[model samples]
Target: MTTDPLHILKTVYGYDAFRGRQAEIVDHVIAGNNAFVLMPTGGGKSLCYQIPALCRPGMGLVVSPLIALMADQVAALRQAGVRAAALNSDLPPEERRDLWRAIGEGTLDLLYAAPETLLRSGIIDRLRNIPLSLIAIDEAHCLSQWGHDFRPHYRQLDALVDLFPDTPRMALTATADAPTRGEIVAHLQIGNDDSFIAGFDRPNIRYAVEEKDNPRRQLMRFLQNHENESGIVYCLSKRKTEETAAWLQDQGYNALAYHGGMDKAAREVNQTRFQREEAVVMVATIAFGMGIDKPDVRFVAHIDLPGSIEAYYQETGRAGRDGLPSEALMLYGADDIALRRRFIDESDAPDTRKRMEQQKLDALLGLTETAQCRRQVLLNYFGDACSPCGNCDTCANPPERFDGTVAAQKVLSCIYRTGERFGQAYVIAVLLGDEDERIARFGHDRISTFGIGKEHDQRTWRSILRQLIAHGFIHVDLAGHGGLSIAEAGRRFLREKPVLMLRTPPPAAKGRKGRAARGGVPVSLDQTDSALFNALRDKRIEIAREQNLPPYVIFHDKTLIEMARTRPANRADMAGISGIGEAKLDRYGEAFLAVIAGHQPDAG
Candidate 1:
């Protein structure tokens, strides 16, 4: 085997060059150093450790969090003709014995195991005798309590440092804020100087957030453009996941549901179908998509707001993992915000942790309410910046803003005079001077603030209230009856009479429209190329079915697009295409080349 990292990259992984700081991180690890890597999803993070492991003498041990993630990575590596295996409870006892035999013989290039398995008494004792090239901890952010997805088992990974004192260790994660990064480094005992902080940016994804007026309709409209494409629809509750999946199926979509509440076998079947099939929509709760390896998910839509910016980033990052054009759509309303806050307040965490969680939620709310470029706000949350991206919803359709101080004051005053115990609908109705028995019974109809808010419509007033909640000027009584009350900031605002600007509620969407009608990102392939692309996908699916693997494990859509356009003619030409390594060239070069050749003009 070649000891050169670049050589292994080209001949084994089939990439012509290293991306970003891959080469630097690989060299540092090869030199027997510890480092932490922070790169976006689909940023080629695996190569940072894989190359060094291949170049070094002993096998690499990767600590993964999920059995499915381990299986997927091992499959992809073996497809590239590398010796990789995963040890988890999913494996049969016979297969486990075989893997251990291979490990004893030093025949494996990489071994993946969960932290719990690695920390087992006899397991660590046995591995201590074997030579280890490096210890890689994937999804390293789980070790940090400050991270969005914290696992107590991951906190025990620090023991690996003392157990393997001489071996290089690398911690890698796709989502981590500044605090989370600090916690991860401190927990893993990695030197501060050894950290490589790659900027967090997934430019291929278009960000869009809509007010949750008609969530089902909004989601349907968003799905129109993604017809016959694979995606994930995230819900906040298990029952919602099942209901949403059923509703989508009624609409003639291949939809499935997944959540922790389902039976274990049912959950696995749904996940397997989602992985193996095309054009399937998986409606799931937050329990899904922690370590999903599917690279062709064209979109991720959230029917409910997530808890924090970190959670939002991690979930949305699952889309567009193949460097292709994808989208992230979120529908949020006052109720979602209130429910999220209630979750935080009701948790058993200390006040400091609750405050931290609240701040994170506030940041997310700010992102949802910002009129600036969504990408800029999102990137800035992670202490990164970028020029205005023309892809997000804000950049495409800039919302109109108006002076809303009087409007805000009217709503706040009404909440106060009405005893601050009514929901938004009743409050808006009172402001609209609706001659209802409930309002007259409470004498809210006579309040001075009631008729004063008649200038703006209910939608406009709702927008103002949402923004006020986001701005910390109002608090939601989620624990009681979802009522609204003025916060300290709102009191100060009424006293000081400061200028306040709020986004005008966007006009109701006219009708159900497809992506083209909504000015969505155009398909990358043209008419002629699309035919060949379709043919290549058919071939890929056929090969995948035969091998009992997901289609992407055969080749990514990006690779197929290149094949269709460039029309590589032979094995050597196919080897030059990205993702086509030497082993794959020998196995699949002719099959793909034939498809391309048949689609040529002269050949027809």
Candidate 2:
């Protein structure tokens, strides 16, 4: 029953060294031990379970929750010369039966099934007779009630874990706060002997948060800086997802929208394109991000706030996945806080659950408005000490702030003079002395405060107003009441006694020609083989068109780009490209050799 333990790591896995704690975790798992790993997206979590699967005797039962999770991970494993298979409701009965037969015959080394599969009547009954080696749970936070994402079916996994207690368990998650970590152990009843970890710091990713103005324009500028790099934008609602995607596409990026509303086939197509193509920006709701395996995404930008800090970390963790320097930008406003509170308060959960939900919302708000460095804010949430990452926009392009107590006093005075009963646009109009029709109708142009703020442009004044609201010096009237009201903090400003500082409105976020890399990265492209890569790509496309499948199905554009950049000259070298499947190298791979042999110019 014993096997050489480290062979898989060096041979089939193709990695010479373990990333972070992979070697230690693999040692534990191969010794019939348990582990709880909290690695980030590209921290090599898969290999910890995968190498052990090959080293153990029976099939490794990986209980994943999503259909796409099973399919993507299984595809990647099978491509890596591992015998892996997945069973899910998405497949027809015939294919399901075929997978079962393979499992029964011991032909499968690893198997992926949804948690709901264990609930099927005869399936669990039959599964009891099969020999099980270990159970690995991905995205283990779903089991926690306090977790932002709670799945009822995942909560039921405890019963299943109790039934198979003898099999060693390892729970792996990309992101989990302390509360969720405790829940994972308690829900699974993991033994005290199991390992628990936080993980390594990817110091390459620069984190930044900008107070909201025109968020769309700001995002456009961020994209322009990382021109021709992969990124993602997460929106809270489906409508915003579609609009942002359409807007980016209009600006000439290959952007795609995905949400739960879309048909399954469309989501799959968009996801496949993002994985295989270059410079694609995917705009999606939260539903689209789980289990996507693409590794080189350069940034994750958020237009709206996520429900919790854990969700934000995991979502942004999708970027900088190849150990390259990347960006995580968030544009937040006070409206986002109100929206989150509305969502949580309106949910049908019990009173206790709603109270917990409020704490989560408060945490997100604190993150948005943190006075400290962005990395310091993030690491503190996870119980770690971190220094200021001197590379973010906050550090690189430091804001110039001036004392604004006088200006705040004037704005509040105008609100009072106008009867304190107008929304932002109207208030701004009266202060700026704009004799627009609304101003005349309200007779606000005749007020004493009118024409006083005319020294500043309308946009600049609005940014100041927004910052005031965010700082809690002023508050928006709720319940369809449209005017601004002075909060308790605003009283200090109105009393002409407090010193408040305000940043200048940031630059318009568009039309940057090129953004030189801020820090920590030297080059964008691998220098060794850029030319030969193009020739191989042409051959791939010609063959793909002849075969009638998508070009990526033959070989991803990423693989071709890497091939040219790395200039691999032999079969073994070609196999190292990330997207090259085994069946692909067996076919159409030799054609790439002629190009690599000489730096052939791409065919005209």
Candidate 3:
């Protein structure tokens, strides 16, 4: 057996070389140094630890927070010819005993355990006796209190450091800003210089944020472009997720609803269906996306605003993980802003945490409202510098901005004149000189700000209001019935009449030119290669069904695309493909070559 990291990477995982910083990370771990790795979701993070586990002497222990994550990783690793297993609640007692025996006998190359399971006295006592090559904490950001996925059990992971002191330890996460990164490092007790931060940019994902107008209609239009592709639609509420899934089903799409509100069996079934089948759309709340290993998700659409930029980044990062072209579209409005603000403000968190949460929201809003390149603004938030990507909505067609000093003063004056206790609809009603009964009862019709904003219609006023909220010129009283209150910045703007540059909301998505609407990410195959790719994919699905595994576990779409493009005629040619390792080649290479040569494999 090869004990070299590079040889293991190629022979087991089937990649010819390390990408970006994987080699540096693997070498550091193999050399017996503690490391912290922050790579993007699809950046091949598993290789950093997986290769080292093969090169090093003993079993690799991975502390995972989710049972599904552990199961998925173990399955994928085992498929890649690594002897991986997980001790989780799903395993029967007999099976657990068998796995324990395997671990004790040193027959497993990698072992994954949920955080709680790892902390069990029986498990730790056994692990202490076994020779350990390394300890890896996946999704290490869950240990940070500042993160959205905080798990109490993750805090207990510090015990692993003492229990396996001689084993090289590493913590890995796909999402973390500077503060969260520091917390993970401190909690793991890794030195600052040992941390590796690969570029967080997922260049394959084309980002598009649109103003919410006729939201269902907007989502429908967006879906038109993504027809027959695997994707996710994230709604803020449980009811919305179900409704969206039902509506999509009514439209002839294979849509499923998944959220915390469902029965455990139902949720698992829906998740399984989405993972195993192609072109299944999962309409879910924020609860649906972590540890999802599906690699060909073509799009991620947000029907509502995420709580923070980090949440947004991580959710969207789930798409295009296989490095194929993908799209992320968010339809946001004033109500989303208000609901998210209320969620943060009404939480039991301390004052400092609330302030931090508010700042993160503001950053997301800034990205949504920016007239500059969306990718540039998004990357800047993570402290990664990049040029205008020309692959986002703004770069494809920049929004027009106008000097809104007069408009801003008018909006602020309207808010101030209305006693600052009214909701957005009422304020817009007053601004538009509408004389409804509520307006009459409140006597807001007589205010000086009444009819002042009539030059721009109601829709225009709503857009301006949402932008103002995003810019921090106004705050929403979500707990108090979604009232709009002017902020200090609004007061200053009103007093000084500073020029406010506001972007005109982009036009509704036309869903034209297919993927071109999504900044032209390459999501399709040409006519000549499309047939072969589909044939290969059909074969992959057939084998996956026979084995009861997700199609991606056999080979990702990118790998299939390479096969179709290259048309490999023999096992050696197939082995040269990116994901076709020696184990895979030995297992199914001849069958694939047979397909390429236009013959069916024997059914025997």
Which of the numbered candidates is closest to the native, going by highest lDDT? 1
lDDT (0 to 1) per candidate: 0.90, 0.74, 0.86
Number of the top-ranking candidate, with TM-score as the measure = 1
CA RMSD of each candidate after superposition:
1.8, 4.4, 2.8
Q: At residue 17, what lDDT does model 3 achieve?
A: 90
Ranked by lDDT from best down, the candidates are: 1, 3, 2
- TM-scores of the models, in the order given: 0.97, 0.84, 0.95
Candidate 2's residue-wise lDDT over 1-604, tens digit each? 2355455665555445676778888888888887787787777787888788788878898888787767767766665567888877778889888988988998888988888886676877777777777888888778788787778888887876667777778888877778888888887877656755745356778777877777887787777677666789999899999999999999988899989999989998898777666568999999876766666678899999887888888888888766667788888875775567567767999989888877766666666655556667677777776667676665666667777777777788887888767777878888788869978887877878988987778877877787677566766765445467777778766776668777776676546444564221213553344344545656765775575443444554456667766778699988777655555566656877776776743432
Q: Sort all candidates by TM-score, best to worst.
A: 1, 3, 2
Per-residue lDDT tens digits for candidate 1, residues 105-156, read 9999999999989899999999999999999999999999999999999999
Error of 1 at 203 (Å): 0.8
Give the poorly placed runs of model 2, Cα more than 4 Å off: 191-193, 226-229, 276-278, 350-359, 369-371, 402-420, 430-457, 472-482, 486-504, 507-510, 513-523, 526-528, 535-594, 600-604
Off by over 4 Å in 1: 511-514, 517-522
Comparison by TM-score, 1 against 2, better one:
1
Q: In angstroms, how far off is 524's CA in candidate 2? A: 2.6
RMSD after Cα superposition, model 1: 1.8
